[model samples]
Target: MVLLLRQRGRLTADTLARELEVSTRTVLRDIEALSSAGVPVYAERGRHGGFALLPGFQTELTGLNHEEALAVLTAGSRRGERVFGLGSALASAVRKVVDALPEGHRATASDAAQRLLIEPETDLLSRRPVTEEVPDTTMIEVRRAVLAGHRLRIHYAATGQPPQWRTVDPIGLVTVRDRGYLLARRSGEDRTYRLSRMLAAEELPEPAQRPNQVDLDQVWRERCAQFLSSDHIAVLVRVHPARREDLLSTAVAVRAEEPDADGWLRLEVTYQDLWHAEWALWQLGTSAEALTPQSLRTSLHHRATAVATRYGHQPESRHLLPS
Candidate 1:
């Protein structure tokens, strides 16, 4: 009621009741309550007048408790705003949220939110994930196209390739792991584009060709399955029990798994290619061993031999050796 009056300047009791989906009597009772609470609510007896708040009067938010306010403040601290190029807008919105809190809870909630961190800080112990830089203009256009059901012309720069102009039907936006993606279709084929890689974008006059309803979660899963099944090599490996999670995290897919007699885990995993498999297994050191595909084992052996030959050479000076 306060926000409505503040925004519209003044509203008749009938208008307020109609907008709020309540009875005029209810609106009158609420007005009395607001006046009793020291709010600057006033009514004009003339038909031309209605309820109005005094100039410069703004109401604090009364909906949130202290914990809910703290949660909102903490969520506002996340790095998600950087991904979509809304940092400035998010900052302004956060300020408004803080200002809306009750006087007694405002300072305490802000102080508590400052103590909680969303993403890890860059330090020796942990490396922060690099968030992609996207232009505000590009994101704004892409978002507008998606929301308005319009086709978009974009200059996309794929990895190891020059930027190419393509017209894609905007479906929806997806954000994964601090990276934003446009889940759209081109020429009736599903296309996914990274927002950071978009060099330029413009909305088209043609209506987008898309389903009436979209289930983005299911679409994302289907796309992931299709990607995993394309141009991937399968390898069987034996991994130490302690390093099971390390292998699972690195592999593209886990096809099969079982425990060996020696208490190690025997599993079949998929990788993008031979080099991908080699690199993943190499990182595990002796904790993981490539069992099948003689080619991978040979490649690992050759790489290890090269490393050994490079490091095994004796130094020319004995003084360089540690005591």
Candidate 2:
């Protein structure tokens, strides 16, 4: 109740009751309780008026415990405030988290947060991370539809396809590795689209067709299972320990792996297609060997032979390093 008042500036009795799923009497009781508890809550009498806090009024984290305050502070700091195009709101939340802490512990909490690091600029091999950019307008509209239970229309350009108009029942938004995606339903069929692929968006007045409540995390996992199981080309390869991550990173899934007597690791992994498998293994050169799929081996052999001929040098044994 207090949070709604603080964020919305003013909310009527009906608004508060509806938002909290409580009676007007309960809201009034809470308002009285807040005032009695030394909060600067006030009620204005008029059609355009409602309960509001005093200008510049601040409150301790009423609903959140002290530990939760620290967690918010840490998360906000780590995400750098600008996550999923909500930088300003996240910045405000972080400030609120800092202010909510006890006077003596605020600085200490901030210092503790600085010591933790996630998703560094580069890995052991100095490879950079991927960060996809979504236009601000597209994100704003998509978020509005998802939050307000409205249908969303988007101009999307999927991979290898021209842009098209799509109206969907927006279920939720997800961000992984800084890449944003919209999980929605189109024509009663599940669909997922990258936020960066949205050229434009509009929030429709009609309500979304999804459930009033949903287990968004569970839905995401189910969709991921379907996506990974579709037409994925499985491959078996032996990779040098030094480039294990290089091979694993490109593959969609790793089903099994073990170390051979020669100290190389044999991995059963899946890629998007045969071309993708061949291209990834070929990049490892002699440090990796594809053990299955004669097509992949033949493709790599031809490429290696062509490279050797261009340099007027005899290619080494076809099986990569000697067994």
Candidate 3:
């Protein structure tokens, strides 16, 4: 209401009530409360009369200390703004936070914040993270439904399948590693939907069925563990000591690790499927070797032979230029 009054200038009780979806009496009572709190709110009596703020009135929000202010500013600098569909709102909030800080601390906080960076474009290997494209309108509706406790119907495009519409009881929205997910229940069964795969969405009039209190962190962890454990295949490999960390990072889990006779580390790791195992080992090149599961070794050998056949040729016989 304060923002509305400041933006529109002199809104009547009826107008304010209509905008806020409340009664005029409630609006009058709120105005009185604002006055008692020294908010500079006043009402005009004559025909062009309504509530207005005193001229040059600005609310001073002085709740944050210097370090707190810098943390808030740094958080705003991160792409977390893009995750929750609050980019513009976050920008406005940062401006208000800076404006509310004391003059002496403001410059120091702002300058210090500039020295920190979050989620840079490229990682150590110059590999950029792939960002999924989500429509703004779709995200807006999804967030609205989640906040308002309303059920949602979404046109979802799952991997290896065509798009389909589904009605879900939205539990909450979670952002992980630059990707957004809608954790919900469909037919009393827990389900997770990727926000990037949401082709379109609509908020239903009916309220969603969800627990009164939700621990999203716990829920996400459980779901991740379940996903990793389902339909998985484990492999044993001997990795060079220097490349052990690389192998561990790519594998879902390191089941066992021990030193072999040649001083290399023999590790057992789990992959989601055969293709996943093949692809991860291929990226390691000669730094690692597959020990067990002769199928994996054969697959890699066949792939290597294919590559050799394609590239192993005389320079005169090979036409490198595109025709």
Model 2: per-residue Cα lDDT over 188-253, one tens digit each: 999999988899999999999999999988998898778878998878899999999989878887
Off by over 4 Å in 2: 1-83, 253-264, 309-323
| Candidate with the larger lDDT of 2 and 3 | 3
Where's the lowest-lDDT run of ten residues in candidate 1?
Answer: 65-74
**Please, what are the lDDT tens digits per residue for candidate 3 over residues 91-122?**
44565566666667877887987897777899
How many clashes show up in model 2? 0
| Candidate with the larger TM-score of 2 and 3 | 2
Which candidate gets the maximum TM-score versus the true structure? 2
- For residue 93, give model 1's deviation from the true position in Å: 1.9
**Each candidate structure's count of clashing pairs:** 0, 0, 0
Alpha-carbon runs more than 4 Å astray in model 3: 1-78, 236-270, 291-294, 301-323
Ranking by TM-score: 2, 3, 1
How does each model score on TM-score? 0.64, 0.67, 0.65
Among residues 3 or more apart in sequence or in different chains, the pairs in candidate 2 whose N, CA or C atoms overlap within 3 Å are: none
